[model samples]
Target: TDLAAWAHQDVPFDRLVEALNPERSASRHPLFQVMLTVGQSLGSGPELGHLTTEFVVPELRIAKFDLTFGFEEHRTEDGGAAGFDICVEYATDLYDA
Candidate 1:
């Protein structure tokens, strides 16, 4: 696999998008599938603390996720990192799977 497509340095976003392999996009990414499971767990926001869940993705990878959902609009130092927290659901024909 050419590592350039996944490298996020000074490369422009459009070129990176154009160079992505369909097979890799389809199921090569375990993190992506993990996020999908997390999104399914969290339907809406206005909650706090960490959410834990598990799932099995390709390559027989078992993912244990503990993601934080914050009701606060801004991130405090105590919160580690904070910003506009929202649950955004989107889709694209980027992956064949």
Candidate 2:
């Protein structure tokens, strides 16, 4: 696929969007309705001497696309795959919660 072949290319996203020149709309993204991202997990917060710490996720107040899915792979102490933290964001104007 052209996308796969060009994955390593250093093209800026705005440039690509400009080149495609899809119909402009205030209610939708220019080229895609959905997006997916996979990345390393956000590790636990720093350790305090003999005190406990918790990882807190802030609230999502905005949606960048119609739908966006994010997967973060967590790793064990010994570098093994632990689990995944998954999250989905959707435009409330377009879809019901």
Instruction: Output the number of the TM-score-best candidate.
Output: 2
Question: How much lDDT does each candidate structure score?
Answer: 0.41, 0.88
Residues 10-41, model 2: lDDT tens digits: 88888888887899988788889999999997
For model 2, where is the 10-residue window of minimal lDDT?
4-13
lDDT of model 2 at position 50: 90
| Predicted structure with the largest lDDT when compared to the true one | 2
- Candidate 1 lDDT by residue in tens digits, 1-97: 4687466577875675567633544434423332332222232554456865444324322223323222325546565445554542222333232
Per-residue error for 54 in candidate 1, Å, reads: 40
Backbone clash total for model 1 is 1
